[model samples]
Target: MSAIRHALTTKRADDFSAWYQEVISAADMAEESGVRGCMVIKPWGYGIWERIQRLMDDRIKAAGVQNCYFPIFIPLKNFEREASHVDGFAKEMAVVTHHRLIADGKGGLIPDPEAKLEEPLVVRPTSETIIGDAMARWIQSWRDLPLLTNQWANVVRWEMRTRMFLRTSEFLWQEGHTAHATREDALEETHRALEMYRACAEDDLALPVIAGEKPENERFPGAVETWSIEAMMQDGKALQAGTSHYLGTNFAHAAGIQYQDKEGGQQFCHTTSWGVSTRLIGGVIMTHGDDDGLRVPPRIAPHQVVIIPMLRETPEDEALLDYCEDLRKLVAAQAALGEPVRVLLDKKPGKAAAKRWDWVRKGAPLIVEVGPRDMAEGNVAVLRRDRLWNQDNGKPAFSFVSREDFSAQAPALLEAIQQALYDEARERRDANVTRGVTSMDQVAAHFADNHARPGWVEVQWSKPTSAALEAATEQLKALKLTIRNVPRDAEPADGTCIFTGAPATERILVARAY
Candidate 1:
């Protein structure tokens, strides 16, 4: 049997929820924080997010957006600027009522009401309100126009129900806020930003997504339109990977972000905001994970290749250790992402088998084992996480390749694993997407029947509205299904709404989401 085959206690097919939690625990990725609804991303997990940050920040900068920091606390009055916008976030906001903590002489510290400020402050649920206020002050003319800025920061929302990386009271993310003098320019910026998100999700994270405009009921509050990239997880659930929004002067109107036009008249700037949070870590975890553990995409994995040296206290063991060290340097010096390839040489004194299993649970894309025998053969044993899940397909836990061949194949292997993960996810999605369904009963049956990994079904709807879909809301909720998106790439189709019987022209994606 493959050494890492039985590492996980649960089968993904038997109990997916428990399997997911187990994978996170076994992988040592993240854990609950002392504060409710917050998470402490361990080094292994944070390392992956750091890779994501580097890749995403580079892409954001290339798109001409500058990074900046914003105050974490906003005055309560700021939220009142855009009533609808603040209304959307009011329930999740964390408010600061007192300025100091004092001993109440009961052996516990209490909030000092006497030190309260004139107005309460809100911990940033989102930066749109405060950023909009800043834009109002920064803009004076059309030349000072498009204030394109992004901030990599932590935000707090009082989430009642929370998960580690998916939904937390506090999480790390990048929120982009941009202002444009013209509506056309603002919309273009919005689209470009969303494309960046799609590029990052698909190209780097190896998660395939359907890019589309959200239904009105699902659009971000105060956004004229919200564009999103939604990816299907292995368990047949949709994960909203990222989003972009066009504000259409709504925030500008509220915050007084105006600029003098070429004709010397003042006009409100059209605005846009978009963000992707740490929730993406969860998306990646679910998208490519299997019964064994996380099959983290190489582009985002902290360590692309981890080399384990199978050593012993023998005269020849020194040579094997030397070979492993040399191989590490050789692999680390090679460039794949324009940065040094992250390589780890596991030299801890322990059982080689256990060490091998350790990296397997960690989901390092490639694991190489070098031993005295391997040194004599001029080759190394390679264990790929992407391939470890395929033991049932008659594949070995690890394969043997010449040292030279392995070094040469290092970059290609990473790319191959990356592409394979994406292709597999896409295949799962395509296989389950039901077609030519024209009735609410059919839709419900499709969702209910996929067993454990029920996936998405693309249905053509004439009237793609919440009201139209809500006709079967009770039945659909019983099935735990909802419309994922009105795909921007959806081609014109001839059909009617399954429930409303309205003439349909576009396809809507339906699935249960995370």
Candidate 2:
């Protein structure tokens, strides 16, 4: 037990990255896999993911998006239909060159030389091609214009480097594909999906995010426009939490998706796609986590409250255990009475304090410890994770409330914690964001110094040509800065291009992204 306890880091301030790995591993959330760029999420971690899926799934269904499935393989011809899309994902595709393999008879395997496919199949990096092909076959009239469908599946992208929940080679996600009769309808769907992403991120996950359109260069391939929700992590870096794209009939035109209108005129169907992935787990970990461990919001925590039994080898211990059993029954009853809370009683022995620490590290919002002292007094010791410095010294800070009266207070306390986490994250986001007039040189300086202020800097480009934009992008890359977006409402500034001193237009957000 000491070895296990020592294996985990104690100070989040000393080494955040190390602490993160410790917390994730100690909580039995995930484990490194033999496969490069892959991880095995333990039951505890999968429970959290399931909770997220439940909430988001309900919301998506309520928004009139029907769930569906599509084939994971796309023929090479289908992939090349949209040149831009192919170009964007060509480097990362995992191609299936053969359909069969046979034994070599020497304790080895060999690809069957005669089992060549007519055309290579590419494991989908995204489902746009296959979904578009199906849409083309199903739609023949304007009445079938607005097709909304969603799929929960795994996608593979051969990444250079991978983090467990952040950027694995294979990850689970929900992607929405919609078709509309006109560009206006497609654009509306894009914005609506963005709003839903924000709502789920902010309200359900308790993470504050900024929503805006991506710059032309950063937009999705084959998309007229792309928008995203950018979340600021605790380490002062930005995470692209989710994205929604407005295709403007690009895919439809490429895949021959056409519909006849009321006037007997045939037109291509406008299209949109949006998705949020497991990367959200990483966002939540970084957003609300502290030095102790993860501090998950009650709204999404798999278990909102944990009860730790402080046992001993005595009659008093037996009495306390009995009391704990009673208390568990009481809490369970309250939960069954429409309390919207899930509680667990941990009865492991050895070190009660250490067990409490473990639960706190797991981000359980409320912890209750039953001991002989409390049993003698006919009460229980309650610990609140959200309250800062509950005691004067600020060491192991918490109030010891009576078990009998806890049900009345626990619900409100959990709600307050949920709200406070959001408020705190919002404040940090506002404080870190910096805005001002500047040149490309100044933008470089700000990012290099680790000053997030200039959350987004306002600069004018003398000439907004592709070459000029490329030069600006190169400069930013050198300085470790990337353009987040080019505001749609940007007006001509009274200055030259920040990089080339050419005539410039509106302000844009330039930051280092994850």
Candidate 3:
């Protein structure tokens, strides 16, 4: 057996949580940072995020939101202006108290007791509070009503538990904050942003997702409505990939974001905020990755193709390295979906198998090995990352294609891999989704079943009475499941809530999510 074949020790089906960390280690995407709850994203991981950021930024700009920045710290008073927002993020906030540090007599530096600040600053968990304050100052009249802005920045949430790329004390993200004169415009902007998220997830990342509004309990703090894109992972857990919030006048009123109307009347502006963070990297990991190793969607892969020169440079075989180099240039020059195909030439000295699986573990979309025989045959051996396991035995299974044909179709081939991953994931999700659960027993059975992937279960939700909603909330919480969303255009259902016998509306998706 190849050592590289055993790169990941835990099978995803057997122990998903352990396999996730193992995949990250084998892939060398990230590592735990010196800070207890933070993580350091390695270059390969950051490269993927850089792709995500660039694509997302273009879409955001198209939506008329300009890129900008906000202070990382919020005055404690600013955070307290919105009571619900403060309550929601209070436990996770990191407060800064002192202004300076002083050398102690013993030689260690300590926070200067005399340098205490009059008002403590809270490291922003999200920029709504801080950005809201800025929005108020920036918008004083009707002409300034639609204040659309986005910021790419890091935030400190101080989460108790941590996972690489998923949840941590600090992470990189792009947050968009906008203000509109009319509620309709704000809502429209919110939905538009949500649609953009859906496109980026399904089309660009090749991950199928359901775009919907979050339930009240799961809504962003202080927002009137919250929209999300949720993707099901291979382990049957749903990952909330991105979110857009319709904040109404909550933040505007709280921050005094008043704009004078054409009629000389002053009114609060409606607001919206949406964001996707490094957590989407986690989504990519669990969605497309297999037990052998990570399999990045071709579009987001750092290096779509890596070429290894399998060399034994006798006078007859001396041309093999030259052939590999020619092939690399041929592949890179071809465009894939308007972007130059990213290709790498792996010339590092080592066991060829070890070198080959390193690229496999890192999830490069394609691996081509060029040798003396291949050079003479005018062909290249290809091992597609997605089809790495489609072999009769442990022996390396590589399919050969003529050099001319491979070079010409490289772009389309990447597209095919991207499509294949999406199709497979969608099939799994569709297969496991159990709809119209008419009873609590059925709901319990669906969630408790460990035999197959429990992608999603749809239940008709009651038109929320406080007592009944609370009961259902507590029940679902006990079962370790939560409603992913109540889709905006979900078809109405005539059934009753599975948790309670109360009359219900449309279906809301429920599952255990990341």
Candidate 4:
């Protein structure tokens, strides 16, 4: 096992991309599948996803959104109804040509020549088309407006590059589709959904994110306006954590969804769609993980605390086990009271310290070790992953706490850990953003020298014309990045443009994003 482990190589400091793959695989979270761009999320990884689902599902329910199911295969014509929507997804769709297969003489199955679909079905990259069709049939009057529904399902989008949870061909997510009588209501829904995503990312996932609108180039294909929550990873690259799109009446018009107003006037319904996918798992890993491995937030960690029995062949092994078991029961009882504590006793035969390290690599927030020494003294050794050991102070990585009183104190410790992680991520984000640039030279210099910040430069793109902005966008693209947002409060500046020094009005966030 040691030999096999030694063969594995990961670039901890120099190659963050490789390090991510190594840590993910080493922790047994997921594995690459036989199918390109797909992954097999292992039990441990799926456990995290399940926790995310439980939390987000509750939020969706509270927001007056009803859960519903839509078919995985959408008719080709339904997709084309919304031109921009189709254009965005056209390149990524996987179409089904034949419906049946038969065994050939050589024993391999072959597509039956007689079984061609009348209208080739496209595996849904997203469900907006089919959902809009449903709304068209179900909505006829103003009373039926604001039809809010959410679907938790898998979507397939073929991609050239893939990561375990970040970018995959198929992944699980919840997409919300709503139709409102007026544009204002639809806009409200979009912001509300974006706010929910922000809360989930910060409060639940413990990752701080900036909530704002996407630049024109990065907006969702069919959306009139798109908003997103962006979080910076440990490596300084931005992650588009979640998105909410105000689709206007585009889909309603395309799908023929019209509602009668109070005055008996027919009008197209305004629509909104928003989603957060398993890519959040990637966000959590990048935001909190260290060189050791993944550091999941205590709230979302599958195993929040682990108890290890520091037993040896000395006559006290049995006593240590008993003490550890008792501690586990105490913690479990506290968890039953809604404190969200999860504990595991490591009874495997081996070096107890090594077992503790194993749990640390798995990102358990807390570890408790019981031995004859500690058991005899009515205490257990406690160690926290969040608290770094101070060599200057001569502090050991582990400390001692009374086993009887641990349950009462554990909750506070976990809360401290949660706060510390959030603060650290916030600090990183603050340090990364750059601000107050008035020239194109400043933008170019910042991008070349510091990717982390000046975090975002507030610049006036003097020429707000589409052609000039597009030209600047092309230049930024060469740097492998783009603008993130246009500030709502941007004012026209008399100064020269940042890129061309022409006359400029708005400030935009520019960054290389995932």
Candidate 5:
């Protein structure tokens, strides 16, 4: 009967891209630095990253991977060692040719010509080449095989077109590099990392993903096989959330990572690398964010529950503060999703209603508001971000419960919100995917409307190679689509290829991507 007033000025239905930018700004997440294609992550934004780092680090460590630090500056020659690897990143690599800056005649600083280095150093884009060099020296015998190492660091890539966390010129990520004695071992590690990413995305971040092997064209340049977890955004575009690459003996051969076998024979190592980055934060935003803003999953939310005491700046305010503080302690002690609940009590100088809306935009999983009257009545108002609106009344769906009961139910409440968000996203993704598309023309017709939210299509293909593959890619390009991946769990193809009309060997998902 009444229209609900959304917190964000840009509605998602009106424009998803604009709405995404608005969420980042209104939620105080991050902003552009003066520098082009870079962002300054604010407290709230960095806080979310910290939570992701902690949880993902735990999984990394659990896989028997030792953490290590690598230099941010890598020798250009190291990249030159692997031609394909170097070519893949050459355009985006930021090179350092001069050691120092000097004053120009115009009173501005410029690179000193006299301080040029013998060889340019590249800002680390990905560390396989450099890390492979280390493996060559550290691994001497078969006993040293299966060397698993990971590093958490920032990397630079000169992205021409950029978006905040999605395509920044500089971003933070963890790269896992391992050297194995055999191809089977390396491939096993590759799949292990893929499963880890799927679990992390689905369980930790509440993102349901399709884990599959990428086509030859989409494989990491030097990789024999590359795998990725593809997630569907609310707008029906695909986000390659994370990737794991099986490099065969490519880098090992280039870097001379040889180990002596039991028979005293030297052999090249098979290597695998997998990584997930801050772009995952972007995926979470697109996957779970709504018109109001982000509804962070409880497991990854910096503060799962935020408590705001409705203070009036009067004598009664002190009593309300004490009541809210007590409530905060109670909620923090309760365990949710295998950890103590994270709760914050806001006692800042502001009206409670304003603060409540601020937290709503930030998508705090639960917001508990207590007023003097509520304290007198021994009750508190709880708002769940996942269920923000009441359809019948067009108002916030706030539930009033007694203080003792609210604290007792906090853990289940947070867990429920987490599951609800994941289910909602999963359902939407499942519904939007168009299957039974048997021809290229059908695929073209399905995505004809640029304004409509056109999702993905799962079509059968002949698994073309070399020239044929290139032709298939060009055909898809003409339709403004690309193959996302061949899902690991897809049904065996019993039809003809959509492109060449050959007997289909596999099924691939085609979609527009970020």
Candidate 6:
């Protein structure tokens, strides 16, 4: 009936990028660290990351992978052993030349020339080279095959351009590496990792993703094949949420990871590396954030339900807070998403309305407020982040319910929110994908305007090789798009290739990505 004023100053429609940055700030998730291409993840942001880590680690360990840590500084010689790996990351690697620092006499410190080591070290961008060396030492026979290991760590890439969580110079992530005895086993593990990412992103994070195989040109530097889970952001751009690379024997050969078989012969192990990073947080913001702020999916929300007592700083405030505390305990006891509900009672000194908006902006799944009147009536006012406003009144869509009833229904409500977010994202993604485009001309025309929010195009392709592939890539580059992936469940191609005009073999998704 009337215009609704949103909590956020920036609206997604007006400018998505600015809106994204605004959400990060208004939600208290993160901010620029004053260093180029780096950010400081605040408590709320790190809390979300911790939840994701706990949930994802459970999934990783369930697959029989063991946790381990590696040195942050990898020897330059280690990367030199893998030419392709070095070539791929050369521009981004942060090299450590000297071991110590000295005063420059100008009140600043500089690397001490005298402390230079015989060999330079590279801050790890990825662990393939270093992990390969460990696998080589740890495995000597078939009994040690399928050595599964993972590490949660930070990596430096020296990015020239960065956003808070999306593409920073440094970011946190979990990298899974495994060595298999045969090519078949390695491929299976790769697919398993991809499926794991798909399930985690969809079920846990409520970000529906398309799991697919990347083309040769998009594969990891030394990988034989690479697969990724791509999620569509609200702005119609694709975010590569996670990737699983079937490295084959490339890294094993580089690190000399050989094992003796029952036949008494030595063979290089086939390897796979897969990872998901903080970038998924960025995906969540773009996928579920509204004009008001972020609408975090319940499964990954640090605090699913937050109770803010409507404190008046009077004697009656005690009773309201006591009632809210009881409600918090009840909600916390209830199970949701196969875990105990995480609910917080905000007893901090603040106005209830102010605190409610604070939690709302932070994307807490549910916010409950109890006043003296509500306490006397044994009721609470609840606001669902996913359904924030009532257009009829241009006000917050608050529901009044008895405390006992709300506590009993908390688990189901959370599960529903998680499913609803996933459904919304999936529907949007499916609708935006333009299918059955037959030619490069059509694809170009469809995304001709740079400012237009053209989602993606599914077209038939011959899966060209070498020079032909390069030419096809240049054509797409001219349109500021790239081949996102070839969906694993796509229909068999029945038309000619859009680029080469040859008989098409598979369907590939083309889109502009983050």
1-514 in candidate 5: lDDT tens per residue?
Answer: 5899999999889989999999999889999899989999998889999999999999999999999998888999998888788779999989999999999989899999999999899999999988988999999999998899999999999999999999999999999999999999999999999999999999999999999999999989799999999999999999999999999999999999999999999999999999999999999999989889988999899999999998888998999999999899888889999999999998898998999999999999999999988999999999999999998899999999998899999999999999999999999999988999999888888988664778889999999999999999999999879999999999999999998999999999999999
**Candidate 4's residue-wise lDDT over 6-94, tens digit each?**
21256456688888887788667899889998999987688888888988998999999999999999999998888888889999999
Give the least accurate 10-residue stretch of model 5, judged by summed lDDT: 447-456
List where candidate 4 sits over 4 angstroms from the true fold. 1-11, 311-319, 335-339, 347-350, 388-396, 450-456, 462-465, 487-497, 500-504
Which stretches of candidate 3 lie above 4 Å from their native place?
A: 1-6, 312-318
In order, the Cα lDDT scores of the candidates are 0.86, 0.80, 0.87, 0.82, 0.94, 0.93
TM-score of 4: 0.92
Lowest lDDT 10-residue stretch of candidate 4: 1-10
- In candidate 3, position 138 carries an lDDT of 95
Q: For residue 34, give model 4's deviation from the true position in Å.
A: 1.5
The per-residue C-alpha lDDT of model 5 at residue 166 equals: 97
Write candidate 3's Cα lDDT for 1-514 as tens digits: 4433555679887889899998898999999889888888898889999988988898999877899988998899987788889889998989999999999989899999999989999988999988988898999999996999999999999888888888888999999999999999999999999999999999888888999988787888899999999999987889999999999999999999999999999999999999999999999999888877888887888889999888544465447767888898899899997799999988776666788888888888898988778888999999888888644566556889988889898899899999999999898878877787887778788778775677788889775756767778788888788889987667887888677677777689888888
RMSD for all candidates, in order, please.
Answer: 2.1, 3.7, 2.1, 3.6, 1.0, 1.1
Write down the TM-score for model 1.
0.95
Task: Give the alpha carbon lDDT tens digit for every residue of 349-403 in model 2.
Answer: 7688888877777778888877777777877777777653334444555567778
Backbone collisions counted per model: 3, 11, 0, 12, 0, 0
Against the true structure, candidate 6 has what lDDT? Answer: 0.93
Quote the positional error of residue 162 for candidate 6 in Å.
Answer: 1.0
* Superposed Cα deviation of residue 165, candidate 4 (Å): 1.2
- Return the TM-score for each candidate structure: 0.95, 0.90, 0.96, 0.92, 0.99, 0.98
Pick out the ten consecutive residues of candidate 6 with the lowest summed lDDT: 444-453
Query: What does candidate 1's lDDT look like per residue over 1-514, in tens digits?
Result: 3444467889888887888888888899987778788778888889989999999999999988999999999999988878788779999899998899999998999999899978999999999989988999999999997799999999998988887788888999999999998889999999898899999999999888889987776778899999899998878889999999999989999999999999999999999999998999999888887877788898998999999888776688778888998999989988775567888988898878888877888899999998888888999999988888454555446788999889888988888898999899889888877778888788777665646666787887665446654664554678787777788887787888665677877788878898
Error of 1 at 217 (Å): 0.6
**TM-score: the better of candidates 1 and 6:** 6
